[model samples]
Target: MTTLRIGIIGVGGIAQTRHIPAFLELRDQCTIMALSDVNIERARETAEKYRIPHVFENYHDLFSKVDAVCICTPNKFHAEISIAALEAGVHVLCEKPMALNVAEGEAMLSASIKADKVLAIGYHYRFMKEAQAAKKAMQDIGTPLVTRVQALRRRKVPGWGVFTNKDLQGGGSLIDYGCHLLDLALWLTGNQKPISITGSTYNRLSKTPNQINIWGEYDHDTFDVDDHVTAYIKFENGASMLFETSWAANIKDDQEHVSISGTNGGLSVFPFELYTAKNGMLLNSEAAWLPGNEDFGLSQAQNFVDACLGNAELIVQPHEALQVSQIIEAIYENDKS
Candidate 1:
C-alpha cells in the first residue's frame, strides 16, 4: 500500500475526538506528518499526544509537507482552509456542515475542480453500513413521495464551548446536530432538486438567565442562536420532506431517524426497520438486518486518499454536498421570516 502523508488543522474538540484517532487507525496506509492549530500550545499538545513529527501554528505552513489535510475547524473556516489546501495542490477532507453558506461551498468546489485534486466533505455517516443498506432498501419503497428527519434531543442542549454562540457556529443544533440527518436524507434521496423551503426557529428555553444544560452550565441569557428548528421542503421531483431538529426540544425520546415513504412501502432508519404495504396483512413486517458500525471517519479519510491516488471513486462529490449546503441555507433564510 502506498503511504499518503496526512496533516490535521484545528486541534479542537472534533480534531481530538474524531480526526486524530481516525487517522491513527490508518497507520499502515498513511503517514501522520503535521498538526496545526491557531493555539500553538494546543497544536503542540495534540502533536505530542498523537506522536506526529511536524507541528505548525499556521495551516498555510504545513501545505508543502503533506499529501492531504483534514480541516476540522468551525463552520466559517471550512471553505477558507479547503480552498487554501486545494490551491496549494493538496487534497482536503473537510468536516461538516461544509460551509456557512452556499457561495462558500461553491468557491471550495471550484478550487477543487480547478486544482484537479480530491475534495470530500465529512458526511461520514453515509459510509455506515446501515445507511448504505437503507439506500439499497430505498428501491423497495419505489420512488419516495415523502421523507422525514428528526434529530431532536429533549432538553440536552450542548451548553459548552461555542455551542451557544451563533457567531462562531453559524446556527445551533439544526446546523450542528441535525446536519448529519439532513445529509443522510439527501444522499438517500439521490440528491433531488429542492424547489422551496418553509422553516421556523425558536429559543424559548435559552432566553432564561439560568437553565439546565447537559454539556455544562452556561449563561442561557446570552444564547443568541435557535435551539429549535422545523422545516418543510418541496422537491422539483414532486417529493416532500419534513425536517425537525433541536437541542432542547420538548419531545419524548431523543429521536434520530430518517424515514422514506412510497406507494409500495416505507423505511425507517435508526431502528433500521422497513414496512411494506403488502402480503394480505395490514401490518408491515420488520427488516431483518444488523446495524452498521463502520468507522465512518476512517472510511472517509481512506476514500479521500484513494481518490487522490486514482484507485477509487469519490464517495461524496463536491456538487452533491453543495446541494446539501443549498438546502441548509434555504432553510435558514426562510426561517428568518
Candidate 2:
C-alpha cells in the first residue's frame, strides 16, 4: 500500500476545522506532509500542532514535497492554486465553488487533464450517508422532472474570515453556501446540462444600517455581496430546478432541502424519504436507518485519497464541478440583467 503525501494550502479555519482533521483520520492511507499559507506564522503553528513535517510560505515551494494538495484558500485563489498544483504533477482536492467562475474552472480542469492527476472538488455533501442512499434510490424515481432546492439560514451570515469580502470570496450565500446543495441536486440527476437560467440576488439585508444576526456582526455599509438568491433553471434533458438560498432571510429556521419529482415517483433528501403510487395506492417510505459513515468530511477525504491511489473514482469530478460553476456564474450574471 502506497501512502500518499498530502499537503494543505492555506492554514485557515476550513483547513484547521475540516480538511486537516479529516486527512489526519485517514493517516494510514495518506500523511499530511507539508502545509502552506500566506500567513506564515499560522502555517508554522498548524504544522507544529499537527506535527506535519514541513511548512512553507509559498504553495509552489511545498508542492514537490507532497503527492497531493488540499486547497482551502478563498474563492479567488482556487483556480490559481489548483492549476499550479496540477501542473506540478500533484492531485488536487480544492474547496468548492471550484473557482470564482466557469472560465477558471475550465482552466483548472485542463491543468488536471494535462497533468493526468486527480481533480476533486470539495462538495462533501454528496459524501453524507443520506446523500449516498439517495443516489442509489434515484433509480427508483425514474427520470427526474424537477428539483427543488432551498438552503436557507435565518440571520446567520458568517461574520468571520473573508466570507464577506467580494474580492476574495466572490458572491456570498449562493457561492459560499448554496453551491453545496446545488452540486448535490445536479449530481443526483446525472449531472444534467443546464440550458437556461434566470436568477435574482439580494444584499439589502446585509447592507441595512442595523440588523439582527446570529453569526456575529459585519460592517453593514461595506457589505457588497448577495445575501439572498433565487433562480429557475432548465436543463437540456427536460429537467427543471427551482433554487433558493440565503445567508440571512426572514425564514422560520435554517433549511437545507433538496427534492426531486421524477417521471415515476419522487424523493426528498435531508430526511431521506420516498414517494410513489404503488398497487393503485399512494405510498410514502422513509428510511428506518441508513448505512455508511456519517462523517461526510472523513468520507470525502478517504475518497480523494483512494482516487489518488487509483483505488476508487472521484465522487465530485472536475467537469461536474465545472457545471455547478456554470450555473452559479449564470445566476450572478442574470442578477445583472
Candidate 3:
C-alpha cells in the first residue's frame, strides 16, 4: 500500500480537533507532512505540536509538498484554495458549504474536472452510523414524497471564530451547522433536483442587546448574518422539502431531525427510526446500535485518503456539493425577493 502525504491549510480549531487527528489515526496509510496558516506563528505552533515536517505561511507554498490537501479555511476562501490546490495536482478535501455561492462552487467543480483530481466536500454527517442505516432504510421506503428537516439550537450561537461575520462565513446556522443535516437529507433522497425555492432569514436574535449565548458572546452590533432561516423547496420529481434551521430559538431544547415520507414508508434520522404499515398495522423500528461520533470523522478521512490513492471512489462528489450550494444560494436570493 502506498502511503499518501497530506498537507493541512488553515490550522484552526477544526483542523486541530477533527481533521488532523483523523489523518493521524490513519498514520499507517497516510502522514501529515505540512501545515499552513495565514498566521505564521499559529502554523508553526501547530506544526511543532503535531510534529509536522513543513510549515508555510502561504498554502500555495505547502501544496507541492503533499499529495493531498485539507482546506479548512473560512467559507470565502474555500473555492479559491480548492481550485489552486487542484490545479497544483493535489487532491482536495474541502470543508463544507463548498463555497459562498453556486457560481464559486461551479468554478471549483470545473477546476477539479479540469485537473482530474479528487474533490470531496466535508459533509461528514453522511458517515454517521445512524445516517448510514437511515440511507439503507431509505431504499426500503420507495420514492420520497416529502422531506422535513429541522436543525435547531437554543441560544447557542458560536462566540468563537468568524461564524458571525457574513463576509467571512457566508451564513450562520444554515450554512455552518444546519448544512450537515440538509446535505444528509438531500443525499439520502438521492440528490433530487430542486425546481424552485422560497425562503426567509432572520438575524434578530443575534443583533439584540443583552442576549444570552451559550457558546460565548459576540459583538451584537457587528452580527450581520442570519441566526435563523426557513425555506420550502420543490423538487422536479414532485417531491418537496420543508426546512427550518436556527442558532437561537425559544424552543425547549435543541433538535436535529430529518424525516422523509416516501411512497411506501417513512424514516427519521435523529432517533434512527423507521415507520411503515405491515398487515394493516402501524410499525416502527429503531436502530439498536450506531457507529460512534469519532468513527464518522475517521470514516470520512479514510474515504478521502482512499479516493486520493485511487483505491476507492469519492462519496461526496463536487457536483453533488455544488447542488447544495445552489439550493443555499436560492434560499438567500429568495429572501431578497
Per-structure clash totals for the candidates: 0, 0, 0
As a TM-score, model 2 comes out at: 0.98
The pairs that clash in candidate 3 are none
lDDT of 2: 0.94
Which candidate wins on lDDT?
2
Q: Model 3 Cα displacement at 139 (Å)? A: 1.5
lDDT of 1 by residue, 1-337 (tens): 3788999998888888888888788788788899998899988988888899999988999999999999988888899999999999999889888888899999999999999999988888788777877888888888889999998988877755677788877888777888889999998988898888999888887677666666677676688888889999999999999999988866777888899998888888776778875568655556565555478777777787788778999888888888888887888889777
TM-score between candidate 1 and the true structure: 0.95
The RMSD of every model to the true structure, in order and in angstroms, is 1.8, 1.0, 1.2
Pairs that clash in candidate 2: none
* TM-score of predicted structure 3: 0.98
Task: Give the alpha carbon lDDT tens digit for every residue of 1-337 in model 2.
Answer: 4999999999888899899999999988989999999999989999999999999998999998999999999999999999998988999999998999889999999999999999999999999888888999999999999999999998988999889999999899999999999999999999988899999999998899789989998999889889999999999998999999999998888999999999899999999999999898999999878454688899999999999999999999999999999999999998898
**TM-score against truth, every candidate:** 0.95, 0.98, 0.98
